[model samples]
Every structure is written in C-alpha cells, then in structure tokens.
Target: MAIAGASAQSQTYVLDKGWEFSQAGSNEWMSARVPGTVHQDLLDHGRLPDPFYGMNELKVQWVEKEDWLYRTVFTVTADQLKSDAAWLTFEGLDTYADVYLNGSLLLKADNMFVGHKLAVKDVLREGENRLMIRFRSPVEETAPQWDTDGFNYPADNDHSEKRMSVYTRKAPYSYGWDWGIRLATSGIWRPVKLTFCNGAAIDDFFVRQQEVTEQVAKVDNQLEINNVISTPKEAQVKVVYAYGEQADTLTRTVVLQPGKNSLSMPAWIEKPHLWMPNGWGDPVLYTFTATVSVDGKEVASREEAIGLRSIRVVMEDDKDGKSFYFEVNGKPMFAKGSNYIPGDALLPNMTGERYARLFEDIRAANMNMVRVWGGGIYEDDRFYEEADRNGILVWQDFIFACTTYPHDPTFLKRVSEEAVYNMRRLRNHASLAMWCGNNEIYEGMRYWGWKDKYSPVVWKEMTEGYDVLFRQLLPELVAANDPGRFYMHGSPYEANWGRPESWKIADSHNWGTWYGQKPFESLDTEIPRFMSEYGFQAFPEMKTIRMFASPEDYELESPVMNAHQKASIGNFLIKKTMALYYKVPEKFEDLIYAGLILQGQGMRHGIEAHRRHRPYCMGSLPWQLNDSWPVVSWSSIDYYGNWKAMHYQIRRAFAPVLVD
Candidate 1:
C-alpha cells in the first residue's frame, strides 16, 4: 500500500448539491436535498400534501412502506484524487440503507443513530463519481424479525399495526408517539461528506476536565490520531486554549505508527472561571485548537469551544431512603425545568434559529435543566451547543423508550456501537449532567402486569434480557467510555408508582394525576425524592389551532380535530378533567382557553409542591416542554412555537425566588 506524505494535508467536499431521489423502482427522479427526508423532498417537489394538516397524515402513510433511492454526482479534481486515502462519511442514515460508489457496494447501514464512514481510496476517480444510497423501508425490513421473534414485546407507543418498532434501531417516535404523527421518514437525514487525507488525520479531540476549582482547573487534551502509513513518522502536536485575553499553550513531539495512536497532553489553567448553571453565575467558555505538524508545517488540525465545569448526580443514602440531586461545583443544585421531546416530527426542520429561540425561552423562564426524552433522536450538535452557551444543564437518555427490546447478539452489537458513538460525540459538552439508560422500561415490566401476562419461563427470559441490556451492558459502556459521569440504569430507577417505598427513594415519574385519573392535588400529596415526570395536556392557542383546523372543524370531536389528537382518550380526558375544576366552555375557542388554564394550574401545583420540599425533592420536570407536531398533548409550547398558558405559568413557578 502507498501512503501520501504530510504535504498532501486533507480536504473535505460536501456531497450536498446536485442530488435527486425517487422511489426505488420508479424512473422519475426529482430534485432532492441532502440532510433531509423523503417526505420533505416530496413536499418540496409538490408531490405530497402537508402531513401536519388535517387528515393529511393518513394519506402519507404509504411513504414509509416503500423503498427509496438517492443519488448524487460529485466530481473529484485530479490533484485531490492523488491523496493516499479518501473516505465517504454519512452523519446519519435513517434506519436500513445500502451505499454504493460508482457501481460497487460500499457499505450496509442498519442503525440510524450511528454514523457510517467508508474508505473509498480504491474506488476514487479523477472525474465525476456516482454515489447512490438505497434505503429500505424500516417497517418492511423489521416486520420479518418481529414475526420470527415468536412473541409480542410490549411497545404500546408504536401505533402501527405491525408493532415492528422494537426490532428497528431508528427513532422510536418516528413510528408513532402519542403526540407525533406516524410518518416514518427515510433518506440521508444528515450531512454527507467525502474527505481526502494524507498519512494521518485527527479522529477525535476530547478535552476531559479532570478537576475544576476556583484556584485551578486540570484537563487532559486527548487526541486520537489515525496514521494510515505502514511506517512510523515523527509529528509535532500543539494544543492551545484561549479564554478572554488569557491563553495557554502546550507542545509535544510524538512518533505515530500505522493504525490508531492515542495521545494525552495534561495541562492546567490557573484561576479558572467555572461554567455555572442558569441561576448560579455566567457560563464561561474557552476555545481550544489542536494542530498536528510535520517538519513544523501544519498538516491536520481541529478546533472547538469547550467549558470547564465539574458536574455530578448525587445519589446518597439517607434515613428516608436515597437522595437524587445534581451537584455542580461541589454544591447541591435543584433541577428546575421541563422534559424535552423532539421539537419537530421532521428533525431537519429544527433550524438554528429555532434552537436559539427555544433556549431564549428556557433562560427567560429561569430554568437550569432540560431532560432529553428517550424516544427522540440524539439532537444535533447545535442543540447541545446552545445548552452549553445558555448555562443550562442537560439530562440525556439513551434512545430506548417505553418498550422492551431484543437482546440477540447482532442487536446488542449494533446497540454497543450506537452507545460508543454517541458517548464519544457528546461527552465533551458542559451541559451534560447525567446519562440515563431508558425512560420507563423497568416500571413497565414490573408494575404493568407483565408477570401475569406471560408464562414464568418466558417472563424470566424477558426480564433477564432487560437486566443484560440496561443493568449490565449500558452501565459498563458508560464506565469504560465516559468514566466519572453519572450513569443511571433507567430514569426512576428502583422507583415504581405502585410501591409506596419507591416514592421515598431516587427519582419518580408521578403519572397519578393523568394516567391514574387522580386529581391535580395528587401531585402535592404523592411527592417523590425527584419529580422527573408529571404534566397535564393542553390545547394549543387558537392561532395554532387554526393552522390545522378550519371553521367547520372547530368542534372538539370533529374528524379534523380528532385527527390531530393521537392519544386514544385525549379529548375525552381533557373534557372530563376540565369539568372537575372549571366551567366547561361552550365555544371552541373558549374550550381551548379553558384547557390551557387547567393545564397551567395543574403544572403550577406540581411545580410548587416539588420546590416547596426543597432538599427532599430535588428535581421537577414536566412530561414535556415542546410538541413534535401541533396536537393536544402534554406540552407547554406548541409545535408552531406558541407558548401556551402553561408555559407562562411555568415561567413564574420556576423563578429563582418562588412566592408559593
């Protein structure tokens, strides 16, 4: 094998232009956009209706069941094609996809959460090259596996009749969530790029904070360098950190051999300004640049902004049971915020402006934390970047939610890769406070009466598989990859709503007010150590309601309105729950207003109850902060970015100084 010297450096070309997509067997190819979905492309080409509008979602169900093909022609210059290595990378491939370069198969991708990188040095040409990705239907690809499993795993949130979400590694909410539409999108959902590199390239650059104090902060600037050449080469590594007018530099020389080389350069910053949560202090940040040079000339380099902060989740044994709270800079901090779902059903639409506005809302509300729910995709880098900048903390959950999954070796291997990739990608964020395994799998298995539904042997097998994945595999990965970070097997771990003792320990998801049909006062009565989930649903503002409903569809139970309501008993529950506290309004707009008032009141009671308890109750995050689509769901903010009455009430409740 031949290798290019350091003189070649590295260059990247984005394959985002001149792309087209069509059904797999169809001859028509319309203009397409990379980092977008098939549904989005169809709408762009005027071939599909708006799915979020009244009754249009049902008409677009066929899109997720068919195979789609995407192709793009990109040219490589003669000078660029002479590099030692060329690699093609996809940031995200929705579910099952097969990649081809020119006419040869390049890679088969099965998980949407994991990025794929393929070595394309052998297939390169000096001129134009054809790249095609054939995406199989996630539903069709996983249907057979569900059939062969011989048992129906509990996945109640999957609204499709096939119930095949458990077998696929895509976003669980894409199949269907109570608040989101059932539009399983498939395409190159993220960016695609081709890179030409020389003998070495920077694989990963992690600035791990070893310790943080007012005096000094110690960090290890770890760099993973991949050297493609057969022989060893001497290279100069320089790392520089800059904050305000002050800067620090570290320089070293190392010999890089073939394959991967791990290098860590330990350094310290004196009199560091700590990154603090929303209410504590300013969230100071520093920028760093790492450059690799051969013969004192820069060859490859990486630069990023980072924050130096010490954060940990404190779970200490108390006389009552156990305490669950977050400690930042050695002081216990109460988490005050709401749970976050995917802001849009189609994720690409969550633009930077949207993120900026959302964080502004969070900061204005005096929120210090946000829980990224399990059913959604790992959000884009911009999401965390905004969190880091706003001085907000993030509670991240692995993308397994409200269901049991298969534990076959192949499935576990894919999961392991997904875990490692995400951990490495997100571990450097200052806002990352904890890693939770899943949302409510343990509670569903134990308290949802699975024990009585299946035979003892089958039940044993199911529970064992749960143990292996959550208790063993996930925690072990967190230990190995992201050491010192807080790891919880699942949210509300060892805490079941049925068990009174559960409320005295760890975290809790108190759904008694909604799912249990209890009154809003139950939030005050049945308090837990950490209130992780509790919220009531509200109709969006009338302006948002008009987005999907017309004058004729103004009635609560109208077909168009019901089409927007995905919860089975959503309308009935709202009406019933509202009649108990407030006067049932007659007009459609009044009804929406009344629902928002009731939701706001209910959340206010919960938030006040949690905050009043102080050290006993450490966190209070409602079921959701935003909606996936415009629907009557448990969200403070509507899909159209309208703040419901509940959001304003929440803003008052989460104030640093509460009157209640």
Candidate 2:
C-alpha cells in the first residue's frame, strides 16, 4: 500500500517482532508480540491461568488493575535512512498509552478506537533504535473528574471492572458486558508499522458513487496527498478503474505543496453494473488503483476494490403515518438482519477468514443487514469489505452507548476528532446503509434512573451534552463531511429520545420476554415498525461450556457454571422459558440441548411474527448475531463457530421467500 510520488523510494516494514513486556510497576521483562495483549503474553509466560477455565477469571482480575509496558528495538538500514522522512504508525493501541522512541516522547494516545500515524524522522538513525510504550490503566484513565457539581454523574466502576468504560474511548465490552469476558487488554492490539517515504505520498482516498443507471454511473473520489517537502513539485496522479475484465485509466497534473493537500476527481462508467443486496441480485464489485508519478516514473500507489450502487433512506411522515425504509436502486425492500458486536474479545486474533466464515453463516441464515452496535469498535476493515462483496448491509452506530457521557470540553474535543476520523474512514462502503447515534442512551436517561442519579445542574449539563453530541454535533459532522447517507438520532425514538409514538418514526427494542417475563407468545401481541432488538438467552453449547466448566461441575448452581453465566437471572429465565415448550429435563445434556430448542422456538416466533407484519414491521435485527465469550446469551452462533438450534430456525424463518 505504498504511495508513489516524486521519489520512487517508499518502504513499509511491519514492526511485529523482537518485543519485551512487563507490568508497569514491575521490572520483570517477558517476551512480547506487537499485535497481542497483556493477557496473551502473560498466559504465554505461564504467569496466569486461562481466564476461561472454571472460576478462573476471578483469579486473574489483577491484570486490569495495573498498567503494562511494552518495549522493543528496531534498526533503520542505510537504504531506508536515505528517505527524506520516516514515520511511525500504530494501527491500534488498546486504550491509553505514552510512546517513546529512542528515549524521546513521541505521542500520548488516549483512544483505542482509531489508528495513529505521524512523522518520526528525527527519532530514527541509520542504526538501531529503541521504542517503548507504557499503557496506563484504563480505570485510572477514565476516572470521573472532580468538577463544580462533584463527579458529573455516578462513576460506573462496578465490582467486576474498575474502569468506567463509558467514560473512556475504549470498547465497553472490555469492562464486563452481559455476554463477554472482562479481560481488559493492554498492548498494541493491532500491527505496528514503520514507513520510509521520500517527498509526497498519497495519505488516503475515498470514492462515492452518487447515481447509477443501466448504461452509466457517476462516481466521485476524494484523494489526499501529504507532501513533506517544502518546495512545490510537479506530480501526475493517475487513477485506474477496472470492472470485470475491462480496465481504464485517468490522469491529472497538479502542483504538490507542503503539508497535506486534498483534491477531488470525478469518473463516469459506461454500461455500469449496479450492486444489490442479498437475494435481490449479484453484488457486483470493481477494482481501483491510484498512482502518483513524477517525471513519468511511478513513486507511490494504492489499490482497492469497491462496488457501485445508489441508496437512499425513505422517511416520509404526516399526521396519519410515517414511512421508514431503505430504497436501493429506487426499490424499497425489507431489511432482515441482527445486531453485531465484537466477534472476539481478542480483537487482533479475529482474522479475515474468521470474518468471512461468520458472515457466510449470516448469509446462510438469509440475513441481509447487520447493526454494528455502538458499544464496540467500529470493526476491522475486512468486515465492511466482506459485507460489500456478500451483498449484506451494515447499520453503524457511533461509539456511544448506555451511560451518559461528560460534556466537558476535553471529552467533546476527543469525540469530535473520533467522529471526523471514522466518518472519513468508513463512508465509502456501499454496504454501509445508515448511521445511528447510540445504542440506548436515551432509554437509560429517561427510564433507567440516570435522571434520578443527577442533581438539577448536573442533569441540565448531562442533557445538554446528549443533545449536542448525538443531536447536533454528530449529525452536523455527517452532513458536512459525508452527505447523502441518513443519520438517525437514536434508536426507538423520534427527533429525540422521548417524542410520542416513537415506535412509528424509529426502530424499537422489545424486551418484555427477558425483562418482563411475558409469555413467549407476547411477540405476537405487540410489535413495532422496525423490530431492531429482541432476543432470548441460551447457553453456548455444552462443548463451549466445557471450555470454562469442569465435568463434575456441570450443574447450573455450580461455581464454574455460575461464574461463567453473567446475567444474574440468566439461568432461571432460560429454565423457566424452556419448561413452557419442553418437558423438564432430568440431566445436564438434555437441559442444554432442550435449551437450544427453547431459545430457537422463542426467537423464531418473534422473527416470523415481525416478518408477518410486513410493511408495518419493516426490519428485524434481533438483539445480537455472535458471541465474544462462551456463555449463555442471545447470540445464535457460539464462540466456537457452532450454530445453535436457533441458527437453523432463523434461516428458515428468514428465507428470502417463505410460504405462509
């Protein structure tokens, strides 16, 4: 992915080898891997037991309490040193980290949700160089600050995790989600890379296909070039576009100035092939390459693949009714899918093949859309790439979830930067359907006791923060930066979180079954326009449970089993629901197998019920799609990639065409 510019010498080296790690307070250094975690490294060195083992997580809670340090040394060869600039880049840093290169402070990173790249020429030499990163405890990093009204809201530092994940720019699930392991990781969770490039280089580029017809399509691209040299240079930028076997090139000449220069280009395709979602048609894709050359020699290059399509969110409301649906290629269609979360707690270990396999399972289940929940990372690039190729749509939520966030200037500034970076990063994908503000912040404030917890002044500040962040700042940023795509303020709400008849204007999450203990038949009684979130919990298969439970401790009340089950009443709920459809099981295996069928029947009932409502119920994205840890939850697929009974039932219920 090197960009060719005036100087044809651009080298990228993955700095993934020869690393050492230790607890921040300890000097006992251990071998480390760049793209790994403190837990993985500690387990590798036999310093701790498996957190998944029976009642073992309780023993390893020490890992999250202390900061971790990673140090490494790399050499810049004479050839690489010849380049005019050297840059150090980190695709990811778990949460809060301070980086030092050759004993000079480089940068202090506070967000785990985005990547960072910056110049390091002055810190490098022709020989060996040292790099060190100290990751602070996420709990300490996100501690509630003392303000005029004491702590703004209650610090949600629960017993399991000291970190108030809602206060930090880190994955919320890392701090004990209902269906996850609480192993707050620290380290370079993504690849560390060093690049040597001379003069100008293409930093990033994005393409937007605005309109498409049978014979032609209008596509626009924004290309950004970072020129380090102070003197202007004559640069020729060529863009090559290929569809199937046909390829064509377009070239433009421009003067490259110092700092960062961004430009735009337009391209039209003849006889353009349109992209479609699952079951509608084939998801056609095209390849593209951007190259920068000076004096007729290629200096830098970027190659990528994309799909062509026109999409719009139709929302027309009047006094009587409101219409909210996705129109692709001018055709309104029903959306059937499930909410998505982090596929794995060990994020760096989630490979492209893993994403492909999981998504294939989704397609097999006849789902077309997946909601990337706000509590997790924006997801790795491969996820959107596969969604594009597989004809699946993505509903992305900004990284704001359950808890009320601070309106302090520092927090707002960080969120603003985070939004801008991700908006530019992910706006181009054709599979990206819509943008949502948060998961359930409004519900928490209005109904979940957030208002009761705050004083009058604090409540005013909190409400203002919510409005500014979700209502104003986020939407304005999206409109100014990436137009055309629809941005919903929040789910299960209209205009704001509490507008009357919100279900008619936005999606709804019906949780009567799990929270209210309503009968399994309740899904048929009350429904909404878009049934976005509703689910029944079931344990991971017996095989998955064995990973964390011992054979002798298979009973529901056993310490191993209880320790693994997160929801306080999860087992009771499952047992109670299972009895309605199935006879009481005498043994553990029977209960486990019967639980699968019980969950399947309940979820499939809701799915079918939602689909039966048709235009009245435009979409069905159940509570979740996959699991981050092996425990009883709503996920249809288990941690080991085994499909529970619900997977098959969902496949049938969500069939592209079903006969009633």
Candidate 3:
C-alpha cells in the first residue's frame, strides 16, 4: 500500500494530461492525453476513418518522424525543496524520450521498459517549474536489417497475409504479433514522483543472504550514498532484517566527508529461518530497513523485503546425460513456473493489481518461478515486490526481444541506457534470481552464418558485432552494477567465443513441435543444463473471452475458437483462470474443464522428460504459462486465462522425488 521503497515526503504528480504532439521536425501539433497512446487518441477523436484497419501501416508512416511532447507545471514549496533533493522520475516512456526541465535537458534514454530519474537541484525554481518531454518512437531505420536471422521482413503478398507476415521478423512485434499492439505515445505513461531527501541520500543497496550452514546465515549488504553537505558528518547505518517471525538488526557508524561513499556491512544470523516457496511453507520474507542518521536525526533510509535462502544450479551426470538441477540451501528442488511478458503491451499502463493477481494465480497453481521473457519491457518495482512476497523467483531477461536489433551507434547507445536504467531500478529486489542477456539472440545469429549457417561477408560482420555486444559489452555492464546475481548469456544458446567465464547456466529453448516438427518429444534426448523453455497451449476460460467480446458475441465464443482468435486474447486469461482452477464456476464451465485436461497432459510429459535427465538438466521452465496476446502454441493457459489440464500436470510433475 505504501508503494514499496518510496519516501513518505515524495509527491506523486500525475503527468496524465496536457500534452502537445507533433511529427518530428514539424511545426504542426495536436493536443492529447499524457498517459494514453497516440493511436488511442486518434481513434477516439475519429481522426482515422477505420481505427484498427491498417493500424500498423499508419503507425510506421506517422510514428517514425513524429515526436510527442508532453509539458506540465507543478509548484513545490521552498521548505520542501530545502530539506530533500527534488527528483523527477518517469515510470515509463515508449521507445525513447528526452526530458527537459524549463527547456534544460535532464535525461535522454530509450527502451520503454525501464524508468528514468533526474535530479532537479539546479533546474528547479521556488514557485513553479515546467517539465517537457519529447518521445521518439522506434523508426524503421532503427529496425534490424531484412536478412538478419531474427529480422521479420515484409512479404510480397496481399493485405490479408500482411498481418501474418509481421511475425516473421525479429522486431518485438514485426507489426502484428498476437501479444503485440501497434501503439506509440510521446508522453509520460507511468506515474511521476518528486522525492525530497535530507543530508546524505541512499542511492542504492543490495542484500545477499547466504545459507552457509543449517544453523548459520551469512548476510552481506552493499550500501551506496551521496553526501550533499560540505562538512563531514558522522552517521550510523543500521540494517534491521527479518524473516517471518525472526529478525536481526545490525548497526555501524561511519564518517562521511561530502561527495559519495559506499560501505559494505556483513552480519551473521544464528539458526536463521529459511524462506519456502508457496505451498512448501509460508513465504517468510525478511524486511530489511537500512537507516542513515546524523546525530540521531534520520537523514536517509532504504527498505526492502527479501527471502533468506541460498540457491545454486549444479551440473549432474545421469544415464540420460548431463542435466541441471537447483540446490536450495542444501537440498534439491524442482522449479515449476511460467514465462512472463510485460504486464501490458501498451507501454506503462500496467497496474499493481494486475501483477498481484498474476502472482497469486501462479502460487495457486503451485508454481515457484516466472521467467520474464526478453521481448517485453523489464518489469516495474511493484512486480518484483509481489514476487518477493509470494516466494516467486524471477528469471529476468534483458530487453533484446526475439531477434537481432540494429547495431547502429544510436541503437547501441539506447541499448546501453536501457540496460543501466533497468539494472539500477530493479537490482535490489530479492525475488530476482538471474539476469539473462537476450532471448534466443545467439540462436538466431547462428542462422545468420555465425556457425554452420551461410557465411557471407555481411553476415559475418553482423554476427561478430552481436557477439561483441552480447559477450563483452552487455556482460561488462551487468558486472559493473549487478555483481551479486547470476547471468545467462542468451537463452537456449550454448556458450561460444567471447562468452564470459562467469556465465553460470546453459539455457535452451526447444520447439520440436510448434516451430519445427510434430510429436514434440525430443527434450529428453537433447543438450544439457537448464531446459529454459518448452510449452504447448490450450484456450482460456470463457469469462476471459467475455472480457474482450461484447455480451452478444460472448455467447458465440468458447474454448474451441480458432488458433488465430486465441492469439488475439491477451494475458487477461491468467486472472480469469484463477477462479476456475480454484473450482469457482464461471461461464462455459465445461469448456474450461476440457482445456485444462489437455494442457495437464502436455505439462506432465515435458516435466517428466526433463526430470529424467538431472544435474545436466538443472531446471525446466515451459515456453509460457500465460499469454500476452492469446494465440495457441506453448502456453499452458489460453488467452481467456483458463487453466489447461497442463497446469495441474505441471504442479505434480515439478514435485520433488515424485513417487507412483
């Protein structure tokens, strides 16, 4: 309820109104809502004759050179400004944005997933201040080359086929992917907050709890602070951490002389309690509060809720081959989970309630992990908070979606900004288990002639370029900021040249049935490490279908809808299925029951195959558990959010040392 990790004095300004928009380099402008997409405004005002028809075409032509400018004014009292540093933060902006304070550039960044913040120290005035922002949508030039392995290209075909062709390219949506929507907005989408701080401010802090022995826990704290005052100040930094009913508090005093300072604090807990995944036990989260005070007056503070547990992936060899298994504390544990996409495809509009419900459903299904797929935006703080509270481990992916994006200087710069910003925002959450570099980027690159594919000169250059970026630049960036967590080079790609020695897991995404061949039964006989992704889909519940369909149309819709229609249904299904999976009857009850049975069988087979292979097969996370936009493929649930039989099958399959 308190908007975790936020300061009490912080004022949330809704920059959801009064935006002026225009095409880039053009003088003509129109007024629109700050938090709404440009397409929505145009449709609502009837600016376009057929709002949905040729939407992507219009988006490509109009959005490329257009920039949406959002301007707003807010006044803060001098008293409030004097005590704490005033900071302006955007929860999210689409593609790219350049923010200005009274026409003075504050921050420039790309990648719609991460939030941005700027210090308004020198730019703020006592009475009123103007904040203007310009958002540039990703242009065709920003798209990767046509021949690039993951690049989706336009086919020479009729308009009817154009929609289907969009998915062939690697760009996030390729224009018409089912889970994707073509909407661009040049204004702020998420909430904007102004925080006032005093003395030294808590910049960042990360807590790592290691279960050294059954009775002993080693906790390490990394704290960073910025000293705003000129004179030296003696301050006490105390960390009070609690797990369930057990709590441990430690305090240390340090002398700070202006500028910046970083401190590491280590503490020991005897007979510390462990956090169990949902159903295993209560999700005992330790509340960590670090307070910095000068002369007993609290100057700055930071708080985080974390679970206390040690997790490691070990390679084991069995009769089948090498497999990967996760060791928690000291015992082997099976991971059951789903793949997650950004809460909303329409940038920055996801609500906290949405995340909460999703986590709750995941727990109800006996899942303990959620893989945040790479194609979507990095999740917000609220997402991590819910996962932490619910004992859900997060496998986070970087923003490099399905394919290779442009390696141009501008695009590279934007990628770096996105990386740094996301790392800074979500690094401290305890729920984050690992950071994956990209999803299938390397595998796709292999098709571009990196290994056995056609070795053209241009293809070589592209492959080498991505290799350097992923193996070198991206890893370096992660090391500089997020050293405590684990990182996977790219999902489903084996380690090759330029890969870091610190890379921990061998991840794979096998689609033996949907993408390649049928029978879908080769996972038990393939390569090792973590079986990161493999899945099959079923239709969602009727209630979920109803959300998108009109009352009259709802009667016409059921779980047996064609695959194409299923793809149009979004993630709203995960929520709809929660009630049904718990036996709460809704509309089309018979269809929901039938779908779940089919899904359950698929999950049982996949998990059984994965478990038979161990040590070499550290874990197996299905292709997806929920749908961002409902189409039928690997997801266990359909677009309408109905539980396929696979959902229950997964729960039983992932149970450790299953008997009978």
Candidate 4:
C-alpha cells in the first residue's frame, strides 16, 4: 500500500468552503463558512430575530443535549498518496469531535484547545473522500448553579450560596449581561488541514541543552517516531546543529527499527556561544536539523532552533520565611515581563504577524518573561518561535480558568490529550520555562460558597478530583513526554494532602485590593512566592482612549462611560510612573503629575516591600501586561496598545538593578 502522497508535502489546504452546519438539535440547515463563528454568520443574514433578550437570542441550549455536524468533501490523488503519507488534522474544534472519513469513524477527541490528527492511510481513495465531523460544545447545563443569579446578586449574599457546581448551573449572563450576545453552539471554529509525510515519520522531538562550560556543551535530543509500515524497516536518524558565525557544526546519528520508537541522542558542541537576552548580547539561536532516512532516502525531517541555557528557581529559607529568585546560565536574574492572555478570544483568528508584534513589544520593553494565563488557549507554534528568537521565557499555564471544571471521563481524556499534544508541540523550544497545572482554581474554592465560608463538599471535590488530575495525571504525562521541564500544581496554591512533593516552588496570587479590600495598603509583609494579580488598571493614553471615549473621559473624577474607564484610571497611576522615563524629563512634570507620582510611589513601595522581605518572596508578575479585547483589566496599558506611566515603573522595578 502506498502510504505517502504528493499532496502530503503541501500540508496547507483551503478548508473554508463547502461546510454544512446547523444548531445541535435543530433540523434546520444553515450554510456556514469554515474558520468562522455561527453567531457572526447569523448576524450577517439578520437571522438573529431577537434583541436584548439573553437566552432567546443566544440559545445554544441544543449543544448541551446534542452534537453539531459539519460535512465536506475533499480529494487526494493516487500519485499524491504514493509520494507521501498523510493525516487529516484539525487546528481546533469547539469542545469534542467524532471524525469520519468516507462514512467510517476514524477518531474522537474532546479538547478544544489542542489540535488533533488521524492517520488517513486506509481511509483515503484515489480521488474524492467524504469528511464529516460531529462536534459537541461544552455542556451548558454543567455550569455552576450559583451563576444563575442576576449579574451581581450574590454581591450581597453569603459566599456559601455562591459555591455551587458550575457543571450543574447556568453560565454567567445566561439570564442576561451587558454583552448583548447569546451563547453559541458548536462549529468548526479554527482551521482544518491534511498533512502528508513519509514512512517512519517524525512524530515529535524535544531538545534540552545542559552541562554548559567554556569548552563544550552537552545536548540531549528526544525524538518520537511513528513507523507506519507492517514490516519493520531499519532507519538512520541524523542530527545537525550549529550556532553563530563561526561555521563549526555538531552531528549525531542513531538507528531504529520499530513501531513507535523513542530515541535519545547526545551531541557535543565545541566552544559553544551561549544564547543571551537582548541586553546581554544578541539573542542568538542555534539551529538544529534532524533527518530520518531509510536506505539513504530521507523519509522524514524536522528543523528547530534553540538557545542553550540552564535556569533554576532558588528558594532560600530564612527566619522570616522563604525568598525566591531565578538563576539563568548560573547567574541570578530578575524576571521582568507581562502576563499574557490569549491574543483573541477566538483562537482561529490569531495570526503569525500578531504574535510577532507581541514579542517585539516585549523585547522593546526590555523584558525577559511572559506568563501565559490559564484562561487562554495554548498559543500556536508561531508564538513560541517569536519568544525563542527574542529570548523571552514563557510561564505556561494549563487551560482551566476561573472556576472548578467537571470531573468526567471525557474531561480527563481531553486534558490528557492536551497535555500530550502541547508537550510534544512546544517541547523543543528553549523559551518554555515552567508548566502550571491550572490558574486560580484551588484558591478560588475559598470564594465559591457564599456566607458558609467553606463547604466540605466543594473542598473535597476540588482537593480530591482536581488535585489528582494535576498531581498524578498531568505531571506523569509531562514526564513521559517532556521530562526536562518543571510542573506546578496550580498557580499560587501549594499542593497539600493529595499532591506530590515533586511539585516544586510555592506560588501565590494576591489581589486583595481590587476584588474587595481597600484601595491601598502597605506591602511591608511577606507571603509565599508573590505573583500579584489583579492590580493597577491605567486608562489608555489620550490617543487610544479617544478611539473609544471623549476628552472629558480623561478626568478621573468624572462619571466614566464604562466600567473599563474606572479600571483604566486605577491603572493610570502606574502609567504615570512609566512616563517619567521619557528622554525629556520635564515632559511628564506638572500639577496633574501628582496623581501619576502617587501611582509610581505605591507600585514601588509594594514591589520593594516584597523584595526586601526576600527569600520568602521570589517574584511578582502583576495581574496582567496586555489585553485581549480591552475589557476592564489591571493592565498598565489600554486596549489601543498605548503604554501608560506604570509601564516605566514596572521596567525599573523588574530591572536587574533592583531585584537581582
């Protein structure tokens, strides 16, 4: 049987046309476009018959009970198949998918954040092939029960009443919210492609460079291979790597004959030039090319570029508490960067250019790290490449957001696939630093039940179920796939009874002021490794705010057009601090500067208070560094992409001169 195809060489294909879709349970047919949302299409045709009614207009209730099907036809030639092996791939699907090829079920996957691929060798014909997929959106009925209360009803209620299972209740705004949009059912939200490759393909690869010295550096390459043929065939694996202008190169070779083979190859580089961040020198990258050949014919090949560096997060025990610090290349360094949300709520809409610009901005700001918030999708490959090239470290979080997730078999399977897929895809990048199991899920448990303070049921569910997934499942998955990196159970929450000690470092998310506490307070106290979130929300610059608000909007005391305005003023103080760095010193000096000065002083005092109490506190990544769609956030900048005075204050605070 011919496994490879000529068309396989071109993995990119237009999947935008010929998609037939409908609401999950409705028999009504609707014409839709791939890589688009159903809501947008409905609006364009004025099919959205209702206005200002929450549940009526955005009724995705069908998705809770049934599946939405998408069908399309594609073709592959015999010659194309003979040239390269191919697999059908989906960049993303809403929540769950059951894929079919020529009416035969091929694969089922549940994670919306991770891509899925299925081997199409036996399913493909000489020409046309029918492709159909049934997607089931997340179970709407599974939302927390307490979320049904009108917008802010629970504000006056007890915390115990609010601690309801999200899976059992309706999502926030199911009754109605200001967004004026209804919930949407399933559709092909991202892109779909057919990727072709040769026999004994390169399934995945991870490179970790360690043991660096003046004369030589030790490198380890782990490659995963899928042998497609029934008869075992011997193959040779070769690796070539080079760094910098002096054209010296390093090479290593291994042999394999197998079904699924995990090969580890070690190589030595002579007089290796290390990759450093912007200020240290050029952010140099070492390019690596790996080729798998059968009888000298290249069967598979992959290329990756990585920086050689060793990083360690040291926690020192002192009388007061523990102090945390980061060491890169054996030298202590301060982590200065922003917390990143998804570039777009709609994952498919993000582009390579957008990723490049984000990295460029981080570089321009003279920052070294970016914390990928848990609320967003695991970014595409392009995002990691930009970070790798720019020498920016990534603090990665698994995708569980603000609340407790359902503990179902399907959920477990989905998270497992996500762990495997993302670990494989990004394992090669040197920029990836740490993997956090989830966001504030554990800590937020305390705030779940109103008045009751703590519910034994909710606590048991969170500790036993969610904790097991992270401590046992996720960590084991990463170790099997990519063993070099570290894993944290959940951000800011130490793993207790159910968690393993292997989960290194204690992290905390402090947002006392913004959520409910007083506006300002002294940070003269220390806590577990401080990773402050939900602080400072500066108004956008005059120019950026003009795009959304009037000039009078700039007045902090005036009634703002939106809640985002209030949030921005909160952030404006920090922006004022950043403005002082401008070359023209007098540019930011004025009576109006008083507010800006106060903002800077507060931020400095907060950061210094944590730093001075060292050993117990390691680093502080403020609530957020950027925005996705420009809602109310504690970001120092506004939606229009203008820096506020706080940006400069952050730069100085995170500067090596201070923390390091």
Cα RMSD of all models vs. native, in order, equals 2.6, 2.6, 7.2, 7.1
Q: How many residue-pair clashes does candidate 2 contain?
A: 7
Cα displacement (angstroms), candidate 2, residue 588, comes to 2.0
Better of 2 and 4 by lDDT: 2
lDDT (Cα, tens digit) per residue for candidate 3, span 1-660: 013344433333555444566545766667766566665455556564432222223433364346666666777678766764667777766646788897699987555656766778678888887877777654443434332534332221112322222222122542434434443334455676666666778878777554445687787888887777778888888898876577778889999878788989988878766776655666666788988887777777888876777666555444543445556667776677778765444443456776778787788777788898876667667888898889887888876654444466755776677788788778766567778888777766654343443346546656666776688778988888776566667876553222322123455666553343334344445534566776554555555544444344432243323322424332234224333444533564454555456456656776777667654455778767766544444566554455656766776887655663
Write model 1 residue lDDT over 1-660, tens digit each, in one string: 112223338877777888999898887999998889999999998889999889999899999889999998888888877887788889999979999998899989999999988899889787889989999999899888878866777788886666898888899898888888888999898888888887688899999889998899999999999886778989989899999899989999999988799999999899898899999999998998898887666778888788888997889899989999999998999899989998888888889999999999888888999999999988898999999999999999999998878888999999999999999999999999989999999988878876787788778878888899999999999998888899998987878765778998899998887777778887777889999998788889899988988899999999998888877878888888999998899999899999999999899889999999989999999888999888989999899888888889889999889887
Using lDDT as the yardstick, the better of models 1 and 2 is 1
**Candidate order (TM-score):** 1, 2, 3, 4
Where does the lowest 10-residue lDDT sum fall in candidate 3?
153-162
lDDT tens digits by residue: candidate 2, 499-542: 33555665778888887777779888566777778888888788
Cα deviation of 475 in candidate 1 (Å)?
0.9
Better of 2 and 3 by lDDT: 2
What's the lDDT for residue 475 in model 4?
91
TM-score per model over all chains: 0.97, 0.95, 0.78, 0.78
lDDT of 4 by residue, 451-506 (tens): 25435665465567776787889999988877767777777654221222312335
| Residue 622 lDDT, candidate 4, scale 0-100 | 68
Number of the predicted model whose lDDT against the real structure is largest: 1
Please say which candidate is ahead in lDDT: 1 or 4: 1
**Count of clashes, each model:** 0, 7, 39, 47
* Model 1: lDDT to the true structure: 0.88
